[model samples]
Target: MARNQLLNITIWTALLAPVVYIGVMIVRIQNGEWDLLGPEPGRAVTQFLGTWALNSLLLTLTLSPLKRSPLSINLISYRRRMGLFAFTYMLLHLLAYMTMMLGWQWQDLNDEVVKRPYMVVGVFALLLTIPLAITSTRNWQRRLGRRWKKLHYSVYLVAALSMVHILLQVRSSWTEFVVYSSVLSLLLIERLLNRQKTA
Candidate 1:
């Protein structure tokens, strides 16, 4: 197939992998294979979805830098789909937390958010992603014109906050935080250097 077509297939396959995994988790839970998911499946799935969402966000941000590479594919065109997928995964992450962790108890969710600093940061990031996802379409992009680029810069902040969210939750391991932070820093620096060269 064509390049875009191949990219599309790859994107869909990447997106589907999480869905299939989640389905298997649910099936195992229903089939009394709960040991596989440990004691708290909701918590397990929530963390998994959050990690996937963050990974998608990283890929979305990485596309711009990839386009600067001499060997880059037509990946820039795929950024929109990648961003929307990030938002979709994050929404599922929140829902999974609410359903499994809080048992859909609005009061407990509210209390948890108030009591937990990390929740506030993480939820704020997710909330910021909402507008980005909504306006990711061609229709919205055309309408917004120059302002769209300005608005989409929120992704950088969202990524930072997401890193902080996980960082605060880690008790003993700093390795993941170090790796993600370094990668994000490099991407941000690359973007800035490119902008300066263009200017």
Candidate 2:
């Protein structure tokens, strides 16, 4: 009963997070709360959304390892929710970038793409998630059969590309980069070890 309650809480939290965050940010911005958002409030919003998206992806990766742990709580059912949330966050991040950064300027986007290759990497990562999110249903899972697992393996690539996209940006500190890379590395190492054990 407790586990089920926890799951419900978690799922509801995930569902409401993005909506609540955007709503709060919009309200704060309307009230002239510039201090919290920095000088470039638009950029700050874009970064915040992108960070949450990456966070969701990392959480998705953690599920498999958690299931293998002694204290596992059977969170596998929520994996699809996490993945869909990640994609939704990424979509919002892209929209934020378009509206906030580019101001919906296609020419500017083209120039920015040429100058900032990291944006391309981020776009690719977002693109990769689309198919995964679409085929997350049980019907598609059954239809894909053995190929489903293989297709989903692209998620690791998305994570790697996302990390690279983040590192490519001119951040004031590399601390977040180090933390993301460390977690991803640990997850990958755990997966490799598990594969070896099973082999």
Candidate 3:
């Protein structure tokens, strides 16, 4: 198979998996199964989205390191697409929190963003994603040249902020945060090692 075709399949699969999961959750809610797994619908939905956001972010960060493995070179071509999908999930996460939890109330939105540190961090992460997602396009990559990479480096900041966001929200659940932190650490270490080798 062509590299692009494989990349397309990977991208679609990654993107669709989350959509399917969310659809199933919605169906369960409609069927009155949501309460069976949680104390409240709002909490369950928020938890799902928050977990998905962090997972997608970790997946994006893993792509580069995984590409270094001989068996995983196919992932390199799809890294940009995967990163964009991560941003998409982050956006959905934000939308879910706003629509489900805050109910689109302007005052609630203002108070949450101003009073909640985690919410602020989440918003910052989302904003950081914009440049990376926008530059993922081939045309933008060509137009930006060397600047393209410098701009996309924002992903690291996005990842860090995302970690902070999740950690603050979970407060007690260190398991997910630990897993993501370990992955980020390994990816960063691999990047540094590669830089040293090239230098």
Candidate 4:
């Protein structure tokens, strides 16, 4: 296979690992494993999906730097898949929160959005992703031309919003949030340096 083709194959194959993981999670949920029940059960799934979304976002951001590195393999093409996967996980996370936590009750949903600050941040992040996700296509890129780049830069804001949401959720535990934020900070610094170098 051509090099990029082989890379794509590998990318897709690697995605299946998440499928298996989610399947196992579902089995555990059904089996009442992890002491997940009632409110906790829904929260367990939602948190799991949300965690993947955060990781996916980080991975998507990381790919740009890797593409510029001296590594033999280029990962640019795989970024689209990673971005889409991130959005998928985000959507699922929201759905789980809505269904499991709120039980699809509109009144409760409204209250959650209004009363819970983290929920507001999460919803805002998801909303911001919609435009980026919609314009991810080559057709949209061609259609938007230079404007496409300006629009996509919102990913940084999305990342910030995601971090805020997570931080709000994990107020006491700084380890995971600190690590992801540090990596994101590095990515931002690298991007700035690269832009300056190119200029």
Model 3 stretches with alpha carbons more than 4 Å out: 2-11, 34-37, 70-72
Candidate 2 whole-model C-alpha lDDT, 0 to 1: 0.91
Instruction: Give the TM-scores of the predictions, in the order they appear.
Output: 0.93, 0.93, 0.88, 0.89
Candidate 2 stretches with Cα past 4 Å from truth are: 1-3, 31-35
* Model 2 C-alpha lDDT per residue in residues 1-199, reported as the tens digit of each score: 9978987897878766776887698688889887767889889889889999999999999999999989885779889988998999999999989998899999787789988999999999999999999999999999999999999999999999999998999559999999999999999999999999999
Expressed as tens digits, the lDDT of each residue in 1-199 for candidate 4 is 6976887787777655675677687788777675644457777778888988988888899887888878844677778889988899899999888877888889677767767789989889999999999999999999999999999989999999998987887857799889889988999999999999999
| Span of ten consecutive residues with least summed lDDT in model 4 | 32-41
Cα lDDT tens digits for candidate 1, 37-154 = 7888878989899989988999999988887878675588778888988998988888888888888888677778767779888889999999998899889999999999999998
| Cα error of candidate 1 at position 163, Å | 1.1
Give each model's whole-structure lDDT: 0.88, 0.91, 0.79, 0.85
Rank candidates by TM-score, best first: 1, 2, 4, 3
Q: With candidate 1 superimposed using the best TM-score fit, by how many Å does residue 147's alpha carbon deviate from the native?
A: 0.3
Better of 1 and 4 by lDDT: 1
Model 1 segments more than 4 A misplaced: 1-3
- The residue-by-residue lDDT of candidate 3 on 46-117, one tens digit each, is 667667777777777777777777766546666776777678777888887787788889877777777778
How displaced is residue 62 in candidate 2, in Å?
0.6
Model 3 weakest lDDT span, ten residues long: 69-78
